[model samples]
Target: MKKLLLIVTNIDMYASGKLRTGLWLSELTHIYHSVKEKGWNITIASPKGGAVPIDPESLKPLVLDKISKEYYENPVFMDELNHSKSLEEVKNDSFDCIYLAGGHGTMYDFPDDTNLQYIISKQYESNKMVAAICHVVGGLLNAKLSNGEYLIKGKSMTGFNWFEETIARRKKEVPFNLEAAIKERGADYSKSFIPMTSYVVADKNFITGQNPFSSKEMAKIVIRELEKV
Candidate 1:
């Protein structure tokens, strides 16, 4: 069985503290169920660990999907969120892949976690896969290869684009523009011409999805890459 490390944001609010923000529920649930169905073992971890907040907006009827709704209602699954391991606890564990699940909160915490940067660099340098979706791709922004070069430099990838952020009406709320940041790191970023549509990119050991809607397809890509190994 394959092992997956899923990293989520521990942040419950944006920098402003007025808007509630946290893990985008579907980004975790969509990929979790996709891989779990294959009987893969998964461990959820966060920068600070403990209970991870779910963006309240994500649970709203119009935004919540059936799969996410099911998991949100499952006590067992909710327990996993409530007791997520800290990155410090799993720094030495080996996993076939490390997946970063996105939410607006990721913009604040994902970019600066030293543990996350090391884990991503180590995983990629080992030739294992590192995957991320939506805003959590911000986590990759600061991860550097052992050579001191950025991990994303020159990689073809996609994340939650600025357009989507604007469409979501969070352009001003997010600390930085995610699409621009990815490009600044020299990643060849791209997104769906139609906002919120599924768009995924696979480049060598890295796989990225454009937005929440892209998680399932991104998981399919991750499973395929693992099989190739």
Candidate 2:
């Protein structure tokens, strides 16, 4: 059976300048359901071993909507979130694809996660799909292939943009600008005209979503890539 490894960054309360957990329930729900619907296996992992916290804002009905409400009500979904495996605990070759879910927390931790980067580069070089949404793009910026090139070099990808970061006051939240870091990695980055609109770009095996709104769309495209594989 094919597997989708969902990599979520852990919250860094002090480093994040507040609690910054992976925007998990919305994304984990979408990717898990979508992959399971396609008859694919999914596994959840994070930078830390367990106790994956969610953003307070995302847990609200106003932002989460009906589907999210239904997801929270599911025992299976809640259990997965509760028992999320740590990235240090994964056996990378067991999965066929990897998906990085994002939040402001990712900006703090994902970029510097060398072990996660190693896993991602290993999987990608072996021809597995690597997908991410929002600030999760931080992981991609550091993954280097055996040839020593940045995986995203020359790839057209999108993420939380510079302008949106400004609008979101994320500069006060994170140590660096996500857009600048992505641009430094050599991607041809672009984004939607409005806040929180769904946008994704597929450049070879690298698929990226612009924000939380892009989670389901990114998962669907990731399935497409896995099928092609």
Candidate 3:
């Protein structure tokens, strides 16, 4: 069976030290269910590893969906989240794909993670599919290919848009402008004109989703791309 490395954030609090944020439950679980149902084995990991935190707000009735709620109640899934591997524990070249799950917390740890960037670049250069959604795409900002070119340069991609950030009223809380940073890296960044809608882009082996709403679609696309490999 093909394997997938699912990376989520370890940061639980906003840089402002005022709000709590961690992995967005639906963003991970939606893709998890989608990919797992297709028989893909998944390995969950975090920058710090173990006890992955779910954004509390994501569990609220208004935000939590049937799939995410079921995942929250499923012991097997919960256990996987609780005991995710650390970046250091992940073996290079073991996975056929690498997926970065998104949340507000990713804005803190995803960017500037040299090890994570190396892992991503290695996976991409190795011809493995690499994917990310929402704020998790922040991790790709600094990733460089073996040729020292930005991995995302000239690649068409999409992630959590600035409009959505502003609509969420987190523009000030986020460490940096995710969209701006991606564009700065020369990625042909694009998003849905309507904020918070599902939007996905596939450029070569790199698949990206615009937001949590795009998670499942993103996984489906990833699976399709993997099949073509």
Against the true structure, whose lDDT is highest?
A: 1
lDDT of 3 by residue, 1-229 (tens): 8888999988899988999999999889877887788887989999888988888988999889999999999999899898999998894647989999999999888888887998999999888889999999999998899999999999999998888988888988999889999999999999998899899999888899999889778878988888877
How high is the lDDT of residue 163 in model 1? Answer: 79
Off by over 4 Å in 2: 12-21
Per-residue lDDT of 1-229 in model 2, one digit per residue for the tens? 6888888766745374564545546766677777888987878888886767677667876678567778788887877877889888895457888888877777767887987889888887877678888888887888898999998888899998877778666667676788888899888988988877899998777788998788778878888777876
lDDT of 2 at 83: 88
Residues 57-77 of candidate 1 have per-residue lDDT tens digits of: 889999898999999999999
Please report the candidate that would top TM-score against the real structure: 1
Could you tell me the C-alpha RMSD of candidate 3 in Å? 1.1
Candidates in order: C-alpha RMSD to true structure = 0.9, 1.8, 1.1
**What is the descending lDDT order?**
1, 3, 2
Off by over 4 Å in 1: none
- In candidate 1, the residue pairs with backbone N, CA or C atoms under 3 Å apart (3 or more residues apart, or in different chains) clash, namely none
Query: What's the TM-score of each model vs. the native?
Result: 0.98, 0.91, 0.97
